[model samples]
Target chain A: MLSEPLIERLTETPLFAVGLTLAAYLLGMALFRRLKQPPWLPGILMAALLLAGFLAISGIHYTAYQDGAAWLSVLLGPATVALGMPLYQQLPRIRELWRPLAICLPISASLAAFYAVGIAKLMGASDHVMASLAAKSVTAPIAIGITEQLGGSVALLMGALLITGVAAIAFVSLVARVMKIRDERLIGFALGLNGHALGTVRAFEIGPTAGAFASLGMSLTGIFTALLLPLAWRLLGG
Target chain B: MAALSGFLWLISFWLIGEVVVYFTVLPVSSGVIGMLLLCITLALRGGVPESVACAAQPLIALLAMLIMPGVVGVFFIAGELVGQWTAILVGLVLGTLLSVVTTLWLMQRLMRGHHAE
Candidate 1:
């Protein structure tokens, strides 16, 4: 720990912001690996928790943190683009099984949206909450867009997205183990379809091939949800 | 130069995705659209270019970190979330489990014949 003046000066600089985030993430990664890679102990979640806790304790605003860390978010675009590597590698297999995937993927995507919104409604969630819940399985960007299109609260939508994503990460493996899912591709695809980005990352942990199929699941689900969600919203009376 | 080019390459496709979405009125995000276009490019080129791979690899490795800000933002709304925690949690857990289980079952059952072949 540095002296008070040095610490104060460091916190005021952009380097401090970026350094804090990276350091926390590295620490989380080390802890995750040392802990034998528990799903709930995912590095991203841990890093977020550590940083969020720090911010809360230090009284630093999220906006100030964002200013330094925006570069990381910008990389999400390229990282998403890089997902094509694994998807492309798996193309031959995808083509071979195109028929089943063509049918299965959309059905899964629609069911993901429907079940989420339906459960929320049954549990007496507000219409706005229902709308926000509509695209809960899709990746954040598309989910955020759909939520806005349906006039849902973005803040609440963000909360729901984080919850669904984190929960999917923690529980999807347990579901896979219980179901005896052995095919890495199937496991990855299921996670991607339901888990979104976090699911893809989890799939990467399983193997490169799993990561590939997971991206396929994630990307195709995004496409399907984007195309059908507005009509679905109208039908749901949102 | 390599990283900048890599970033440019990705951003170019992202821009293209945005344009296509605008013209077609698709609900998809620009990033996914860019991903699709890059997939096509890879298919045409016969492999992921080393430059693109190099540029994208670091970002991919650190992918998890990128989502932290959004998760942290959730804290800002902790008050509102507490009210609906039960419903939200139940909907997320049950819905995710049901969806993942059903899809896996369906995929396995549907693809069994293919696997046999």
Candidate 2:
């Protein structure tokens, strides 16, 4: 019923893109709840997929959507800064567990990167792709920079990172159950460090203290891995 | 004075991360390095200013949204991505599985240590 130009202009708006993303996220959330899957599964990745599909079906250029989605992107800076508040509130517990977390985060984060890269290589992926995939479990922005520096595809790395988050959301509970990990602090921290945002959400649901630790782990892991990955790459001649 | 210090702290954290990445052979980012530097500072200093913490809270809360622009940027390359869909799908699935298993295994070890202690 709409004119072609009208539809084009409508889709080009940032609000439309944000709306679509939010709708997809809500849909994913509904499906997750219905299927008894974890919140992160539907909340983030599904929203991404749905948006991807919408663009595909509509034959709309990604550049068009970019106009609308950039606003959402700007929020990332503030969101990252805001994470400090929650961590600040949990200072007492963080203080108590400082030594343990300090030791655990670096080791865990490094292994996660190593294993991801090793397996990707074993699966016969190209060397560049492997490099990009290495930092997928780290947060998105950091992963992008690392992927670019390693001479890998940023597109591939972003896809890998989102998938990593989804996988973490999907399997974290099962892993927790199988491993019999009881301490909320450790579970949440491990999740955040290795899983990033999705893992942080899971940690929050577990408990506020656990959520705080998860943020700590997520922030620390991102920082440490970012610093370490570049050095590791150069050492490997990447 | 406290607010000024907090702002300075944030900048220092960012710079430290950049320096580490620039100097190191690793494939990591300066921002991430900055985050680690901040964590260490917190650990050593005990805590940041309450006002600083408050200011940072809102930013962290929306951290995920900050990255959305990059994600949306993917739409611009959706054509290329679609062309490589099969490889991307394979990579995502396998990479995710590998991350989960490895993280869980490591977490279990950490949990075991916690329980033992």
Candidate 3:
């Protein structure tokens, strides 16, 4: 709503986009805390929605916004490399229950990719969307890496990551209870295995054991998928 | 300086991963390879370096924020994704439920000896 020249000048710079993103993220975090942090509504998801709505309303093109925000994505590489810390930290827990996790992880991770892609394929999602679908079960940082390798849409993968994460919480809570599968370890493992980081946080709320296993689930799933999905894509896609 | 060094450690591993990927043509994420390398290094060392922990933990925690922009790019592709929402949603919801249910069932059966514990 500024003078036309000023508006054009402001919109031309990357800072404008960066500022909006941070502002939205902070606002989302604040509102999330105020609302008591619902599992179905993560702060990042809220931030995403806020940013999307703003872009939609302001008539600002997403490419223009992306030009400025691309700087933030540069940090994703470092953040992904940082996952080693948690994997190392949770290694003991992984060792303790290595048997079940070793058995569950490959199947869970593979099934996650298989169903997501197969269903989306049935739905007639674009080839890009189907490609992105394969990595949603892994945490975002690593998932982004896989998405890039597959030449998939990072946006679609993020959406899938968030939905899978939230759905993991709901199903684990409802189904796990109904079936009398009460072990925090099992609950946490399922959460992380399917939900990634979001489910890991939820598992933490359950207990330390749950938290640790959730960490383990996400970390292992991430590493496994990151290493394997690209190869599988090449084999199958070729 | 310590935090900087920690970042240096992480970046260094990433570079190492890049180098490996460049050579091997492995079709895998270099950062993931780097992550595995670092994890293995930590395992061998039997402890996390303080600086690496300080740097990596916060970065790991803030990863979603860093990747936030790309996620919002969904808007950019709104046209492409316009009619595909139904498929994406159904796949996401069902795939997630199935994956979790499968994990819970498998873990319950495989870890049954510890069930009573």
Cα-based lDDT for every prediction: 0.77, 0.65, 0.85
Q: iRMS of every model, one decimal?
A: 2.4, 3.9, 1.4
Candidate with better DockQ, 2 vs 3:
3
| Candidate 3 per-residue C-alpha lDDT over A97-216 given as tens digits, one digit per residue, 9 for 90 to 100 | 787788888988999899889988887888888888889889988898788889988887887888888888899999898889888988988888889989998999999989988888
On a 0 to 1 DockQ scale, where is model 2? Answer: 0.32
DockQ of all predictions against the true structure, Cα-based: 0.60, 0.32, 0.75
TM-scores of the models, in the order given: 0.85, 0.73, 0.94
Candidate 2 to truth, TM: 0.73
Error of 1 at A115 (Å): 1.1
**List of clashing residue pairs for candidate 3:** none
Q: Pick the winner on lDDT between candidates 2 and 3.
A: 3
How big is the positional error of residue B93 in model 2, measured in Å on the Cα after superposition?
A: 4.7
- Ranked by TM-score, the better of candidates 1 and 3 is 3
Ranking by DockQ: 3, 1, 2
- Tens-digit lDDT track of model 1 for A1-238: 3455665666676787778778888887888788887766566667778888888877677777777677566666666666666667778878877987998998999998888878887888878778877888887766665677788766566667666777777666787788787899888888888888878888998898788888888877876887688877777667
Better of 1 and 2 by TM-score: 1
Instruction: List, residue by residue over B1-117, the lDDT tens digit for candidate 3.
Output: 778999999999999999999999887787888888998999999998988987887887777788788878876676778888999999999988887788888899889855555
Q: Give chain A TM for each model in order.
A: 0.78, 0.82, 0.92
